[model samples]
Target: MNSFWAVFKRELKSYFTTPLAYVFLVIFLFFSGYLTFKEGFYEARQADLKPFFVNLPLLFVFMVPSTAMRLWAEERKVGSVELLFTLPITIVQAVLAKFFAAWLFLGIALALTFPLVVTVCYLGNPDIGLIVTGYLGAFLMAGGFLAIGCFFSALSKNQVIAFVLSVVACAVLVFAGMPTTLNYVSTFLPPGMVAAVEGMSFQVHFDSMQRGILQFQDLAYFVLLIAGWVAACAIVLDERKAS
Candidate 1:
């Protein structure tokens, strides 16, 4: 436990010291502001944050991989992964600590967008419940994507490859419930199987919660997704250590 906490704190603090964190944050804020302004013009809805939340999955699809790509890939590239392996912690503990650190970064990014909420409230009587739910959906999806990103990060020592792999995985998940994907799969699979795949999409379940409907299934899906991927990362790391 001590080792886990140590790793978590160290990783978290390392981000702020490096220029990477500041650069990414600046770019993220720029895009967030741009999207918000664009959404405002197109929707012409004063009190709704529909545009901001609508672009969340897209924003995270790229932002998250940037963070995760460096987690293991950079460490391995510079041969620091060996130093980490020499510690007292197990691979699972390290994986969880690293994952939580990345998730916390995303959480802070989401929190910094509070001005959007204030803007909506100042303009009209917007539903805070929906706003809360939208942020919740965004945060959960970020964690889930980070897990997926972490898996790719462990696959190689090349940060570029890691980033590209995570992006591809995220893209598939983001579009999992889209009509095109489902329609294509519907031709080859049974109706029930196709429906099940659609249900498994992050967007399908996220939409319900983003609209202020807190469903247990959506919550469980994210929890399970994160757990599954983190566990996979640990197993991979352990296998390499043993070999």
Candidate 2:
């Protein structure tokens, strides 16, 4: 536990020390606000952040990868992986610590958008329960994307390659649950198969939470997906260390 906190604190501090974190935060907030007010029709919509939640998954497909691209790729690129391995911490601790650090950084960025929540409340009586659930879903989805990015990061020494691969992989998950994709598959595939594919989509689960339904299955999907990817990352790292 102490080792985990050590790595977590170091990684989290590194984010603030570097300009990447700041730049990412600024870009995210700018686009989030712009999309909510301009594209989301915030002025005209009911007192809710539906539009913002609707755009989050797509935005995360790009933003979250950029944040995670450096988790392990940078370590390998700079020959620091050896140093990491020599430390007192186990690989699992190291992986979880870094994952939590990046995840928390994203959480802080999301929290900074509280002004939107304040605006909605002032405008009309909004369902606070729904709004809270939306944020919960967003956070969980962010972790899933980050875990995917972290796995890809472990596979490459170049940060750009990690970022690109993460984006492509995450994009597929985001679109898999879309109506258009399922519709295309339904033309040839059986209904069961199409339904199976849709069930695997991150969007499908997230949309449920966006509508204020916090089913255990939806939450479990994200949790299990994240664990799977993180476990994959640990395996990759261990193999890389051996070879």
Candidate 3:
């Protein structure tokens, strides 16, 4: 437990000790706000932050992977992974620590968008519950993206390759549930298979929560997605350590 905290703290603090983190944060905040406003936030004149939440999955597809691509790839590239493995922490502990650290960092990025929330509230009497659920859904979706990125990061020593693979994988998941994608696939695929694929997509579940309808299945989807990918990441690192 102590070793886990040590590693977790180290990983979290490392984000701020570099200039890249700040640069990434700046870019994320700017685009988040720009995309929200660009989505007719003012023109629509709605008190809700639908525009803000709507762009999260696409934004996270790029941003979260970039944040995660370095988690393990840099350690491997710099040969520090050997030293990391020598620590008292188990592989699973290390993986969880690193995942949590990155998840919290993403959460911080999400939290920094609070000004948008305030703006929505001031403009009109919006459904506070909807705003809360939207944030929750976005945060969970970010975790899912990060988990996939972590797995890809563990698979390669090159950060660029990891980032690219993560982005492709995340984009596929997001696009799979889009109505256009499903309609196109349904033209040839069996109905059951199409349903299965849509169920597996991040969009299907995220859209549910975006509307403040938090079903058990939607929540379970994200929990399982995060757990499954993080476990895969740990397995990959363990194998690499053994070899």
Write down the lDDT of every candidate, Cα atoms only: 0.86, 0.94, 0.93
Superposed model 3: Cα runs more than 4 Å off: none
Candidate 2, residues 93-190, lDDT tens digits: the string is: 99999999999999999998899999899989999999999999999999999999999999888899999999999999999999999999999999
Q: Is candidate 2 or candidate 3 better by TM-score?
A: 3
Per-candidate TM-score against the hidden true structure:
0.94, 0.97, 0.98
Q: After superposition, how far is residue 69 of candidate 2 from its true place, in Å?
A: 0.4
Model 3: pairs clashing at backbone N, Cα or C within 3 Å? none
Stretch of 10 with least lDDT, candidate 3: 234-243
Best candidate according to TM-score = 3
| Ranking 1 against 2 by lDDT, winner | 2
- Model 2: weakest 10-residue lDDT segment is 36-45
**What is the per-residue lDDT of model 3 for residues 93-203, given as tens digits with 9 covering 90 to 100?**
999999999999999999999999999888999999999899999999999999999999999988999999999999999999999999999999999999999999999
> What's the residue-level lDDT of 104 in candidate 1?
95
Q: After superposition, how far is residue 11 of candidate 3 from its true place, in Å?
A: 0.6
